[model samples]
Target: MALLNKYVGITTSDGQSHDGFIAHVDQDYITLAIPTNEMYGQMNGMPAREATYRQFGFFPGFFPRRRFFPRRIPFGAVTGLFLLPFFI
Candidate 1:
C-alpha cells in the first residue's frame, strides 16, 4: 500500500501495459490513475493545454495524470510489477 498514489508500471497477462500512479491496490485488483491521451483532447474538442511533461522529472511518465481517473486491473491478471525507485 506504500506505493499508493506513486508512479508505477503494470503489465497484465493479457499483454496490456500501463504506466501511471498507483491509484488503488488490494488483494483483488490494482487501479492506475490514467491520463487521457492526445486523442482524448481532440475527441473532446478541448484545446490542448500546455503539458507539464517534466513536472516531476525529465521522464514523461513521472507525472502523467492529466484529466485523470482510476483504471482497475485484476491482481490475478498481473504478470509483472515495475515499481519506481523511491517507493522502495
Candidate 2:
C-alpha cells in the first residue's frame, strides 16, 4: 500500500486535530479532506492558514488511532517516479 494511504490525522501547531483522507501531497504540503466543518477551512486556498505535513500522523495498518513516524522517502525518489513517464 502507498505510504500516504496510511496517514489518518493532522495535528495543527495550535493543538487542533483533524481526521481525514489525504487528497494530495507535495514536498511541503498535504491536503486533508476532513469530515468536520471546523477542519474544512484547511482545504481553503488561504496562504496564511495552510497546514503542513509535520501535523500529520499515520496508522501503519488496521490500527484504530493515529501514530507518528518521522522517517519518509526522500524527495528525489518521489520526483523520479513522477517524471518517469517523460523519460520512458
Candidate 3:
C-alpha cells in the first residue's frame, strides 16, 4: 500500500482522532506513526519550525536517525479514512 509510506489520519468508531503515517497494514489493523503530541507538545505557534531531518536530530557525517512506534487502528474499529489532507 503506497499510502503506507505517507501521512494518514484516521477516526475510530469510539470518537477519537489520530493522525500519523501508515507504517504497516494487514487484514487486522493499520499501524500509524502518530506523533507523540504529549511529548512533542502541540508544536503550535512554531511556524518557523518544520518537520525535517534536523527536527528529530540528524547528522550528515555520523548517523541517519529513524525509530518510531506507531499506533494501531483495527480495520473494524475505524469509522473513517481520511486521505491526502491533514487536520493535525
User: Candidate 2, residues 1-88: lDDT per residue as tens digits?
Assistant: 2645443555554455544555567776655544332222222333332244223321222213223223333233322121111111
The order of the candidates by TM-score, greatest first, is 1, 3, 2
lDDT of 3 at 16: 93
Across residues 13-85, which tens digit of lDDT does each residue of candidate 3 receive?
A: 8999887779899989899986552333234334344445355553222233234566878999898877756
**Candidate 2 — which residues are off by over 4 angstroms?**
5-7, 36-88
lDDT of 2 at 64: 32
Regions of model 3 farther than 4 Å from truth:
37-67, 84-88
lDDT, candidate 1, 1-85, per-residue tens = 7778887888989899987888877889898987665333222322234353344343333333357767899999989888754
Cα RMSD of all models vs. native, in order, equals 8.9, 17.6, 10.1
Clashing pairs in 2: none
Best by TM-score: 1
What Cα-based lDDT does every candidate model obtain? 0.69, 0.39, 0.69
Reference-based lDDT, residue 42, model 2: 28
Q: Compute the lDDT of residue 26 as modeled in candidate 1.
A: 81
TM-score on alpha carbons, each prediction: 0.58, 0.34, 0.57
